[model samples]
Target: MNALEKLKILGESAKYDLCNYVSPNLETYASGKIPGVYNSTSPDGHCMPLFKVLMTNKCSNDCKYCMNHSNRKFERYEYEPAELSRVFMDYYNKRYVEGLFLSSGVFKDIDSSMEKQVEVARILRDYGYDGYIHLKILPGTSYDLIKRAMSLADRVSVNIEAATPDGFEELTTTKNFKTDILKRMKWISRLSNDKNMAPSGQTTQFIVGAADESDEDILKRTNWLLDKFKIKRSYFSAFTPLENTPLENYESPHPKRTSRLYQADFLLSYYGFSFDELVFDENGNIETEVDPKYSFAMNNMDLFPVEVNEASYDELIRVPGIGMVSAERIITLRKRGLKIGKLEDLKNLGVAVKRAEPFVKLNKSYQSVLSF
Candidate 1:
């Protein structure tokens, strides 16, 4: 197949490796006028068009949930490093995308696969295309190649498909959880000690529900990654079974599972929440109907009706509807000697009043009844 045809397949295959926490309701790609262009959301909530595609769809690894699994019988293809760099420049010159996100399956060996991707980044850099680039570090990639990739790209990641050893064993027999994945992540962390390597930092992803792992299991792993690697972020992709694969008959998790994971992840990453502070059901899964922060508030009603004007930044962020931005606004206005004496004042500052009402007091006057 030609480069464009290969991109259509490889690009679709790359979608399973998410770079950000995108909601299901949002469109992830451009309106089909062009192929390989993806609407990737940034950490700060800005959407930038990225030329996201795989270098190849041929694989030697047997990741059961993957469409490009080694056992799958289908047309396979790969792009020459220079060919992909040229195509990306075509998109870049036209202003169609702001950056490039390159990933690949293990075509022959892990290092060879990583080399092809790094070569593409190298070609782009050689051509003076100094824009954003994110390269996927294939599991088991050599430490030196990872350091080289870090030098060329702004961000890099490895998909830690499952949380535990046994859980990983259930997914694929061809890869090792600790040696192939975690050890490589450690190398990325260590190599990252130099400020010039992947300044945007490293990230990782997990396949939700494929290993029969619970939400609690996923969050614990995320917490561990944050503490150990100080990773820039973690992404959760809800498992969707595909045809003719080993997991073809397996059921997909509720869509809300990944969404709830993102919400809870934000709380852990930004809202000053500890894993033990989170509320979970008997099954160790977060609530699908109610968001995690709201559930936390509802579970501990004793902390409700906190005086907004008097609450500390930490305390204000824990409130159900008050986010980091709004909490900062409250503190900023408070320092200016402005008192939030009414619900409308909180609303003007971007607080979700309906959600925050029951949990906050305006100038010590309770705002809403505890209907629950």
Candidate 2:
């Protein structure tokens, strides 16, 4: 097949490797007029168009849920390092995409496979096409190759498909969780401390609901990853069974499960909440109906009705409906001798008044009655 035809298949294959984090759901690609062009959002919520495509679909590993699993039957293709570099440059010159996100299945051994991906980045950098590039650091990739990839690309990632070793074994038997995944993550973390290597830092992803793991299981790993590796983000891809694969008949998770996981993740990463602060059901899963913050407030009612005028920044943020920015605004206003006298005044500062009413008192006046 020609390059364009190969791009169509490879681009579709690369969709599951998320590069953007959108709320309630993960949307990696925008509605582009052409193939391989995706809209990657930044931390500041700016939309940056990216060329996301895989190097090849050929694999030596057996990931049961993957479309390109080694045992699966389908057409497979790959791009020579220079070939992909040219394709990306063509798109870059046309302004079709502002960045490149390159990933691939293991066409051969791990190091050789990783080498091909690194070569593409090397080619791009040598050609003076430096804007944004995110390269996938395949599991078990050698430390030297990892360093080379990081030196060229702005960001890199390793997919921690399962939270625990047994859960990982359930998904793929060929790879070792501790040796292949966690060790590589540690290498990236250590390498990332250098300012010149992967300046945007590293990220990771988890496949939710595929294995017999709970939301708590995922969050526990997330907490560890954030603290241990200081990863930029942890993306959760809800497992969808593909036809002709081992998981084809397996049931998929409710979309809300992944959505709620993202909400809880934010609380741990952005909001000042530990894993213990989150409210989970008896089964160790987060309640899908209510957000984690609201659930925490409802469960611990005694902490409610905190006086907005007197509450510290931490306490104000813990109140339901008060965000980091809103809490900061409250503190700033109070420091200026401007007390929050009414619910309307809090709303004007971006507080979700309905959610906050039961939890907050404005200038010594309780706004609403608390009820279970």
Candidate 3:
């Protein structure tokens, strides 16, 4: 097959991996825009720039959940390191892409595949290409390779795929629950803590709906990674079963659940909600109807009517509609002796008080039995 045909096949195969869609930053250029926001102009500029390319399609490991496993009977293609680099540079030069997000099947072994993956990034950097590069670290790849990959690429990831050990075992028979995958994440996390390691930190992707793991299990593991490793992001992907994979018959997660998980993750990392606070009941799933923040507010009604002028940061964050930005706004406005009487007052100040009123009280009372 030609390069475009090979890319079509490879990219089609990779669509099952959901992290490919999430944009980390919102400051991306609209198509055909010129002079492109210079990288140095704004630190937050070009956050979601598409890093599009797949290096190879051959594999050796038979991960049951993956479409490109070694034993799968399909036409396979492999791009030499130089060929892959050229395709990436061509796109980069044309300004159609900002960077390269590359991954490959385990062509020979984990280490060899990782080494070749690192070579692509190395070649890019050696030629003075300075845009974002996200590399996927294969499981069982050595620490040396991990370090080398980190040095060359701006960001890296190792897929944890399943939340629990039992779920993990059921999905990929070739993967070891004991050491192979999680260890790689731990190593990357450690390297990220080093001051000089890399500007962008480590990230991981979990395949939702592939197994019977609950939202509670997912959130708990996500929290552990955030607390233990300070990971930059924990991506939750809705499992999309492929043509011949073992999970092809399994149903994909309800998109609502996936979205809720993203919100819950944001609450854990940015908002002050704890794991226990986010889960609805003993079973550990979030309420599908109400969001985690609203659920928390409704469940703990007694905590409502907190004086907007007096509530601490933690308490204010619990209020619905009052995100970190608005919460801080309330704190600052209160200090200035501003009387936050009406919901309109908040609206005028750009605070989303609709969700915040159920949990907080303003200085002046609105006509309602509930607090402002």
Query: Which sequence of candidate numbers ranks them by TM-score, best first?
Result: 1, 2, 3
Query: Where is model 2 more than 4 Å wrong at Cα?
Result: 22-32
Q: Report the Cα lDDT for residue 238, model 2.
A: 91
Question: Which pairs clash (backbone N, Cα, C closer than 3 Å) in model 2?
Answer: none
Which RMSD does model 2 reach against the true structure?
1.5
lDDT score of residue 252 within candidate 2 = 93
In candidate 1, stretches whose alpha carbon ends up further than 4 angstroms from where it belongs are: 21-27
Each model's total of backbone clashes: 0, 0, 1
lDDT digits (tens) for residues 1-372 of candidate 3: 766566666655544433333332222333234222212112333244454445677887766667786677898887777777876787678776676667878876788888888999988888889878888888788999999999888888888888889988877767775587788888888888775566588878888888889998898889988888777788777777777877778888776777788889999988867777775666778777878888877877778867776788788788777777777887888888876777787776666766666666666343236653
**How well is each residue in 154-195 modelled by candidate 1, as lDDT tens digits?**
999988989888899999999999999899899999888998
- TM-score, predicted candidate 2 vs. hidden true structure: 0.97
Q: Tell me which of candidates 1 and 2 scores higher on lDDT.
A: 2
Query: Could you tell me which 10 consecutive residues in candidate 1 have the lowest summed lDDT?
Result: 22-31
Q: What is the C-alpha lDDT of each candidate?
A: 0.89, 0.90, 0.73
Tens digits of per-residue lDDT, candidate 2, 312-368, equal 998988888999999999999989988878889999999999999989887677788
Query: Which 10 residues in a row give candidate 2 its minimum summed lDDT?
Result: 23-32
